[model samples]
Target: MSLDSVAENILNHLWMISWQICILAIVVWGLCKVFSRSSASFRYWLWCIILLRLCLPGDFFQADREGYYIPNSLPTVWETPVTIEDALPENYTGSSSPIVNEPYISLHLSFPGVIVLLWGLCALFLGSIVILRAVYAYAQIKIYPRIEDPAILNLLEECQKSLGIKKHIEVLLSPKESDGPFLTGILFPKIILPQHVIHSWKEEELAPIVLHELAHLKRRDLVVNWLQILLQIVYFFHPVVWYINRKIYTERELICDDLAVFYLGGKRKRYTKTMLRVLQESNDVFSAFGAVGLAEKHHFLKTRIIRILDSKYLGYKKMKKLTLFILTLFAVCSIGVFGQQQTTATKAEGEVVVTYSIFTVQDGKEKSLNPEIFFLSGVDVKKQQKFAPGEYTLLISQAGYHHILKKISIPDGVKKFHIQEQIQPLRREIKKTSKDGVDIDVVIDGDFPAGERIDPEIVALNGKDVRDNVFQPGTYRLKISQPGYATIEEAVTIPKDAKTFVISRTLSTNVRKVITQISYDVQDNKRPQITMEKIGTKEKILINSDTKIKPDSYLLHIYQQHYFPIVSKVHVWPDDRPYVMQFQLVSKPVRIRLDVRYDDKKNLPQQLVTLSDLEGKAVQVVHDNHRIKPGKYMLNIQHPDYTFGREKYIQIHPGDQFLILEKMAKKASSPSGKEYTKLFFK
Candidate 1:
């Protein structure tokens, strides 16, 4: 494959892998509960699991690929074209066939190719730097000053005995500028120390750092560190992987500190002091994953001290091992639970369950068939298992035989729905071929209304235009179709003797024009009710996004309370353009502030301000500053303890703002003389 193709594949892999990483991250986050109160060993294992996931690409972890139907090109089915964005400067009226068969992607390289190339270059640069740093660190180990003090060796031996460690470790003193202490290597472990601290450090002060490095070897962290660095070089683009690597190293230090403190009379203060001194002297390249350094990035120093001083941390004896075992089991199971691809083929409440099945055409006498290479519709999502209620087209085609298509309509109704179909086999016959093999002409015979034309889209077997097609002596399926008409499927049999054959078809028209008008509460200042007026009759339909309507002229209206209503005249006809109705309800808003009152309270009566339309549909406002469309509505104040003594009708106009203060509750026996504020901004 060419580099372009390889890049494209990598781009696709990254796209898939990104989503897999997201699922694994969520599972890992939940597994972190074990690290909270359990041993550091589990957290190290968890980091390993995350790093393992990073090394895997998207294709590595997936459920069995389910067999799904693939659709072919058909005339009965229509779809919006896929065009490159910004390819055209003009507004997309969707009036023309936007299929620019050539690459309209501009420039030679594809967009995905550009992204993949950029990622590859970045990975190459970062991987080279990492490898170079690892080589340099190893070279530094070779030339660094060696610590040959016998007393220091005895102190290391003593600490190792207390921790039950048996591996032989070599000690080398780093340059004065180097970081305090660190451990590196696998078969032969090396403990590197700074020269300045080695000369001035007391045996007790230096022993903790030495033992801390030894703890790593016992925990087999050096091997994990190598794995982390190698995978980091491979997946350099993933920030999550790098972050988890840091967490692993940070927690490694904390765990080793626990081991070293256990050796020194569990003296947390003395161990912390030693770490602080080491932090000040050490200056090594801490980015090397395999090198277990004494000091973390300076920001983590406060946290390290806290963890060392804290009674309960990772490696503490706060929680029982059984709990840790169960948590580890639970974490492993959680990862496994979400690791595999989710198989969710669910039907929502009140949604119809649709099942699509296919059978191949039976050959000769044996009526057996296989379900392969059939196209079904309404399967929008990739690997979608279930079908929802909607209009879909199923197209079937075979070699030498004409294509057969059926428009499948699953209407909203009961729960269970099933559709089964058998493919039709094409018949072949030996015949004489003239200068022109066969001629299939498409004709439309019907009276169409003005501004509408029946341009029959004729398709023949073998995907040839039936309007003027040449074919061998065989049975051919001819599909002659037009928008807003019933499709006719005809089979044309060309005779051997005859030089020409004509397959003439007729088209029929149905009611495909509609006009609509809609109206709702104008005073509420909410969205208007939009509906379509039915064709040949006075009916209405509430049109939502993606609603399929018959090809007809329509008048759509969406009007609120008092302003002028929106009117749209839409005509759906056969064309390369979309039938657009660019119109909206026009209205001006008026702001209204309400002050509710009771028997003796001046305002704030604790009443709901209710506004209702003529249809008695009401919307309640709990606070002030509400904008209402210019219209008439019933205004009333309501409270739990008392009812509105009277109801009022209010009319708001454009560019009007007002405050309405009215009596809120049922009047008391002697409160008839009480005054009220003006109800409108006069």
Candidate 2:
């Protein structure tokens, strides 16, 4: 990629990257709130993700792109997709199936250079503000006298000893009625104390004041502050980032307060009083610049005081180790969240979220329907949330009607979309309901969706199946005694005006089903299931088994994980036929040896080759070694001299013995390692 191309890529994705930073900042804020009462260490650690978001260029943990379809997209400059096209050689045309970029959306457009020029100006403007503040704060510090009292020196030694601070911090007296106290310096740190206050105070009150500054150093808030100060300039336009920066400082003070209290025991009353005193007389100390201070504005100071007295913060005292453990976990997550290339499009530009709330309209009003109340997992809009701006599917179920699945779109430009859905009239019979208007008949029927009836022997109502039929005008608790399926207790209410009460019970064999969707790398086979032998090809079962089978004593086994095989306990229905569950095979991981020929006499070029499978796991390509699963693969082969690869299309079949890839040896005047690559999309 040239310099112009690099600049163009960044400019093209400038809005998206900024949008992602804002979103991540909001996430950091929400996570901090959840762990608010827990510990400040974890809360401060959460901001590290935001830091990583700004520092790292790409996404870390990739969302699932298996079924997520990206239309007419191109990969970014940072992503080198080892697509099937890249694996094949030039002048080779075996499979004409289209191959695209991995999970990245790119558009080749003539972007005006003025956007970046204006960006530089805005960044410079913010950067100048931060610099001016630092200069102004440092200038204000110069007006104060350096303190050297023996008593104050002895108190400072005590704070350093207790806080495990080895670096010598210069303590200076602030001007009377000036900045109360603050530790400031981009390169070095100094704690400026109030002149009139410290001299009149004893060790007890003075210890918490100075220890608060030491806590800033111990927690490394200075480094975090400096980083935020710089990044604010980079993302000055995004207000979410400014909010996050404010949150960092607010939480930073609370953390220091807690640390001071933890280290200086039996001083909560004194510590709280000292913090209050500092806030009342607090000047433009740390508040005006990149420094840690005792207190800030009244609004933030009040929140800190309330949080300081919060006894719940002490509950996490014994769990400091757990906080450290969570910090470690967060650090580990940062590796995946920051280091990996993002292979999927998230909430991008012109995308909006659409949320749905379904209601049943009866005689005159709208009655809100809650899926949880009926133990149904219909469109869980409450928890599942509104999907991104795209076509979405929703399943709504009511007692009378068949489950309705409606496809809707979250149109662009709109932020929050409330889709009003009204329930339709019943088309299918409510088989799970009553039989007659007189007596209540308890019948075990098939599952709700499949409608396959299975007779469960042990059926009881309130532990008494003997008297479930024809009950009085009241509600009865009916239960089905089954093992695999959940214990279902459905209530049947017999109205005063009704004659017979019929209650139908739905029994499901499997609670969860894993559907393995298969995609042919070469072409669409239109087959639902594939055997291991006939993995990735046109060969399929090609038959729809329409014959109905009875849900008997045999267990319906299904697998969830790729390698995990599920087995169930033996049943007692006396049905003795083995049933096989099949999955559509997308790609097969087969062992193959690649024969790369340059010349009959010359040995193959010594280079490293690797391939990424459908699941995006990378495996090195060694001759006659390593088996890979079936899927679309990206291949990379490195050579010392001339370019030998292109955006070629090659399909590896299950029954194929081996593949012979040919490369012509061309002399190069200059070794442009990747100049021979194919066009992104054709």
- The numbered model that scores best in lDDT is 1
lDDT of 1 at 169: 77
Give per-residue CA lDDT, model 2, range 448-518, as digits (tens): 22222345656665566523333456676767766445567777566786654555555655432222344
Which whole-number lDDT from 0 to 100 does residue 247 have in model 2? 71
Best by TM-score: 1
Provide the TM-score for each candidate, comma-separated.
0.42, 0.41
Report lDDT (Cα) of residue 427, candidate 1: 31
Question: How high is the CA lDDT of each candidate model?
Answer: 0.58, 0.54
What TM-score does prediction 2 earn? Answer: 0.41
